[model samples]
Target: RDRGGRGDRGDRGGHRGGGHAALLPPGRTPGGTQHAAKEGRASLRVSGVHGPEAGLNGIYLPTDVESHDFSCWHQNDSFYKVWLCRGPRAFWIFQPASQRGTAQGFMISKERHLERPQDATTWRLWRDGGWKVFSTIHVREASPKDVDSDAARGRAPPKKPP
Candidate 1:
């Protein structure tokens, strides 16, 4: 399931970019243009179940987009779902424990923003089992009118139950 995430990243073959692009080392992600990856991160999802034993795991996008790194999705809430994209960039997904090194301890059900700067965070340490995670959001692209229209037609994004 580990496919095309920006972090804990490994090379894959599918899409092919032009030869010798500067964004990555030679022969990394092929056909993935600088424009695609530069535009933003690709959409991806987590692999396997969540647990302390789980450590960090796979992060990959759909096969259709394995070679690209740009996405457009709608989001209006204070928080939205996201995933780490595939190489030099990633969000660093982890077990979400209360204490950084204690993935074996309590784990948060879901993610909030990173509370500390990248330097201060222990969850990023591979030994702690942290892997990069990311997503490119376009909340700005979803207008209030579009939102109203979707909500009126019942095509809106899902709302959390109050």
Candidate 2:
């Protein structure tokens, strides 16, 4: 630690905000975590220690409870569970249980739902296309305790907004 008290490494490239420090890619951060780059739109990034071989382990899908369909949003509230599988060539698996159905419970089918970014807080699906911004994901994540309760632990979770 230097008498100056930043870091012995000496602020290789960090930014201080609200008394908290965060290191940016190249250098320091300024005024907290600002937009890395002001571009048309950014990639949907769901990051955090998912193993190189790990797919469909950290996050869930926005489609129906199945993954076969290559879609983010469905018409009406129709939703499916899709898993992005990475083997020879990455593909979205509709639902492994689609055939046998969930061994534990019933299937989760939603409708009138359009494809939206799974997490809008971090990214916006941006390309040359135009899309509106809306927090369409009305179904919030249930707490662990709530999920563990027998009501939903073994049975299929109740459809939200019902």
Judging by lDDT against the true structure, name the best candidate: 1
For residues 60-134, write the lDDT of model 2, one tens digit per residue: 322222222222211121232322211111111112222111111111112212233332232111112221122
Please report, as a residue range, the 10-residue window in candidate 1 with the lowest summed lDDT.
97-106
Candidate 2 — which residues are off by over 4 angstroms? 1-79, 84-129, 136-141, 149-162
13-105 per-residue lDDT for model 1 (tens digits): 111112222344422333333222224333222223334323223222212222224221212222222222222222223212111111111
CA lDDT of each prediction against the hidden true structure: 0.25, 0.22
Question: In model 2, how large is the Cα lDDT of residue 106?
Answer: 12
Q: Where does candidate 1 stray beyond 4 Å?
A: 1-139
Top model by TM-score, which number?
1
Measured with C-alpha atoms, the lDDT of residue 148 in candidate 1 is 64
